[model samples]
Target: MSTLVQLVLAMLTGGAFSTIVHAVMNRRRSNAEAAQIIAEAAASLVGPLNERLGQHEQRIQVLEAENAHKTTLLDEAIGFIRDLLAWAGRLLPGERTPDIPDTLRDELQL
Candidate 1:
């Protein structure tokens, strides 16, 4: 029940109880070392993984910018085509200009 009683019982067992205690302690130490090794491995892998993620984000931003520029060029081309169609109609006889939608008129400020 008490510490002294336990020690006396262990001593009467010809040191077998001490050997079991030593094995249990050694196993606990081994498990702790294994956990430390896993933590270190995870720490070593994180830096390069984070760097790759940052590079991928930057590449995505550059692609988005290029897409936006292309979209702007296509919008300008559409406006130019609309203007050319209207001018061609004006130069002809009784040709009415194409009716532009209000959404396009507001967006292109035409």
Candidate 2:
């Protein structure tokens, strides 16, 4: 009877140990799988994300170039209008409009 009890106790202890080890192994495998899935997902996103970023960079460059061109044209238009204003001021009867400021002349290279 004592031997029988000891046998049963041994079996229970072995089963418990095996269960704990199995649980630990399963948890490790799950963690590894989760990490792999996340890595794969990030890897999948990299290509499209980089492509979109490149496209945005190109669009930004185009917009910057257009802005620069428009700014140049606007500056020229402003210079022309200033010159016209100076010419018109000379013909007017009232006090002559002040000459273009030296700063504006220097900036416009007029």
Candidate 3:
């Protein structure tokens, strides 16, 4: 009777230990699966976001190049206007010279 009771108790203990181990393993597997799902979602987002960033960089480069071209054209136009003004100053008669009087010329040393 004593040996039979010992055997039954041993069997029950072994069964309980196996059940606990199996539950722990199942929980670990579920956690691993959840981690895999999150990693895949993050990877999927990376591709499109990287593509958009590349496109934006290219657009910025194009706009900068266009702005540089416009600035050069504007500089050239301003230089041309300055040259024309200088030429006009040399060609046109001065107001004081045309209005000078003989008496004032001798007094003012014109």
Candidate 4:
């Protein structure tokens, strides 16, 4: 009787231990699966966002280059206008007083 009781108790203890182990393993598996799902979602988002960022950077570079070109042209135009005005000023006779309108002189600072 004592030997039979000992065997039954041993069997019960082994079953309980196995159940606990199975529960722990199942929990770990679920946690790992959740982590994998989150990682995959983040990875999926990375590709499209990276592509968009690259496109935006390229656009900004293009706009900056265009702005630089326009600024250079504007500077050249201003210089050309200044040169023409200086040439005109030099051609006019210095001693002879030209008829200058008061408003025009004030506006042009002549």
* TM-score, predicted candidate 3 vs. hidden true structure: 0.67
lDDT of 3 at 63: 100
Query: What does candidate 2 score on TM?
Result: 0.63
Native-to-model Cα distance after best TM-score fit, residue 36 in candidate 4, in Å: 1.0
**Per-candidate TM-score against the hidden true structure:** 0.67, 0.63, 0.67, 0.68
- Which of candidates 1 and 4 is the stronger one according to lDDT? 1
lDDT of 3 at 10: 57
Error of 2 at 52 (Å): 0.7
The sequence of per-residue lDDT tens digits that candidate 2 reaches over residues 2-109 is 446545655878667555666676799999999999999998999899999999999999999999999999888888877777677677848666577776776554
Clashing pairs in 3: none
Quick one: best lDDT, which candidate?
1
Q: What is candidate 1's lDDT per residue for 34-85, written digit by digit as tens? A: 9999999998999899999999999999999999999999899778977787
**Per-residue error at 107 for model 3, in Å?**
40
Any runs in candidate 4 off by more than 4 Å, and if so which? 1-12, 93-110
Error of 2 at 34 (Å): 1.3
